[model samples]
Target: MMPSPYPLEKDLGMRYYASDSPGIGGRLRSSPEDFVVEELPLPISDPNGPYLICRLTKKNWELQQAVKEIAKHLGISHRRIAWAGTKDKNAVTTQFISIYDVTPEAVGLVRIKDILLEVVGRSQHPLSLGDLAGNRFDIVIRDCNPEELAKRVQAATEAVSAGVPNYYGLQRFGVVRPVTHIVGEEILKGNYEGAVVTYIGRTYPLETETAQRARRNFAETRDARAALADLPIQMTYERAMANHLVANPGDYAGALRVLPPKLLSLLVSAFQSYLFNCALSSRIDAGFSLTEPEVGDRLLFANGREDIVSSRNRQAALMQIRRGRCRIALFIPGSEPMASHGPMDEIMQDLMEKSGITAEDFERASRFVETKFAGTLRAISLSADVQADISGESVRLRFTLPPGHYATTVCREFMKADPYVMI
Candidate 1:
């Protein structure tokens, strides 16, 4: 029999830490100074193939909402604009956005205040999807102790230098696992629309033992008929089993020879989910999120409460540093001039001690974090910035990471010092 969907230990064997701390619970703490909202002018180069580059305060706005605002201002559908990646709604973010089929003259006619839309350097080639390498960020961290703060900064620098593990951020599970449960149920029901919607919404839950076993069986047998026949009631089981077969080369060949078209499709989806989760976990371990600061990339960060931003901003930056608060931010390449170095393990250990996380709990959490980093995607470049006066007691941090990395894995290290809110 497969393991239970809910693990008794509550660790769930997933690398990303889901904290039991009170209030909004997750890997990241709430900060008032998380984001610096601004609308900067876009630089223009090509007037013919008119593309306007806009920078967003990633910490304050949702990627989807930002896109919508741009689309509306440009008199085009949301489909017309393109971006490199999504930015976190809680921290400051900057990136470029492009408007197609519109001339510079036409673009000049548009007006919007919330977005700092201006024409930056334009290209003859229309800004297609995935046109950016990465994003650059300027984050501020406040209210921290000189000694502890120095130690934390040194540790962060070291971790970045050594290359942090890539894991999926907690956002992938959709705000306390709601999306995951929704997708799991939808998959079980064979509701394609529901599954797709939830997946797009970033609501899919972490893989469970039953799901894993089903996937493994599906891959091994490549016999959808048998799987369906055997597990008719548990569609998730059948799908998982088929997907496992598709991912393994040996299973793929077996399934190709034995499974029918319907089963094949199910297998394909299963394979896709496995691959995606792998990427997601890898990115998280590396301290990154799926949303890029680029164009044409659809990413979402849940900014449930507007007050959180203000609260973080109201505190003294120095006090936050003294408190050893944990801050979360996104970083992009070349956006800022700061240097980055090393993984955050040592800092995590220190903060864990301060936060009162027992050595045993830390060990358990470390295991899950390790599992997430063992996958295919390896860590790439790293960048750093700080958030000050966050939540009147803590500091916020931003790191520029590669695609498919999570920021929470690093956040878990600071859980000892910084309490978080999961909205």
Candidate 2:
């Protein structure tokens, strides 16, 4: 008999597959020829250039902090410096940042040791949000197979050439399913206070079924009621409704389409949480943590210095900056890709078939490959290097993914590893 599906467990399983395995055709460790890493540079500015744009490479620095440092050096506010998006701090990232109201003379004034600030190009208009196309990434892979490697490379190249689905990457939400659960719980308790608190506190756990149920309920409610109606409506309920409306403007028709009031509230809450989670994920990917102004110093930027932001601040910031246009793609690896086909492979195969995906889809999900390496600090080291020849050994892959997709979804089919870190 087939086992009853546990959504949470299934989610965890998918994560294991994506992170632990290599490729779909049993190519665990790549030989020299099989391993390949390439970076695609994204378009920053248009051809017409009078605008002072700089493409600098920073070694071991967070993108946001780099922006702030550059702003301070140039004697400009952080808001003035604009970039396409944020990059991970641990990895050496080369990106473009523009300083408006600065000339070629002033561009030369900024200096930082790790950061190399130069004028890539310039334009009359300042670089604003969503100003450029996607970023181009340069990646390096280690260990590869010359023969089979060619096929794998062809597959990856083809996939990217065809636009990959822009789903939210997992980094947007807390590891696994914490954000969903927290929002769910808050909605069910009718506790706007708790929901607000959780957004600020970042204290929600990943495995709360109650919270998940609440979130589901909220989604149902919003589906029912199109607008916020008054029947002795409290301020908290009104605010919650307002938040729901902002997060899900498209759902208004759907909310109105439903008839019952109870159902309407639930749907509104669900859509609200979804929007909130999406925004939160984007900010976190950009290196901001959750925080609350009311909490003051407890959850401020000062407290979230180590690449960890408060859930509250992250979610609130998301609400403030969300444009409902962000999209992401999560890459997960499977066992077949690692070349270790066993009983586990059969189980994963069944799951994949049921999910309407093939083994190839899992293998080619992302160009980045993650291998498990033994290290002193008990860390999950991510490298862009691919090891295709060594079919049995594990390797690490590092790539910058957009917000709202799960890294683990790529490795759940492989063995479980501790100390999984995504930066």
Model 2: lDDT to the true structure:
0.37
Off by over 4 Å in 2: 1-51, 128-133, 136-166, 174-196, 204-419
> What are the TM-scores, per candidate, against the unseen true structure?
0.44, 0.39
What C-alpha RMSD separates each model from the true structure? 17.2, 21.0
In candidate 1, what are the lDDT values of residues 1-423, reduced to their tens digit? 011132311232233332222211122323524433232322345655545554443345566666776667767777667665544666555666766666666666666544455556565554432355544333344444444454554455444433332333344443334344334334334444344334322312344555444444544554544444444353442344345444643343333323222223332223223333343334455544322211111112222111111233434422332232322222221111222222222333333244343334323322322211111112222223433223433455555443434454444333323222422
The 0-to-1 C-alpha lDDT of every candidate, in the order given, reads 0.38, 0.37
Task: Kindly give the stretch of ten consecutive residues in candidate 1 with the minimal lDDT sum.
Answer: 371-380
| lDDT score for residue 50 of model 1 | 47
How would you encode candidate 2's per-residue C-alpha lDDT over 151-257 as one tens digit per residue?
A: 54544333322222222233333333335434333433344444433432232345255444444444445321332332123223333543554466544332232
**Runs in model 1 lying further than 4 Å from the true structure:** 1-33, 36-47, 50-52, 56-59, 109-113, 126-129, 140-153, 172-190, 193-393, 396-399, 403-409, 415-423
Give the Å shift of residue 379 in candidate 2: 32
Per lDDT, the best of the predicted structures is 1
The best candidate in terms of TM-score: 1
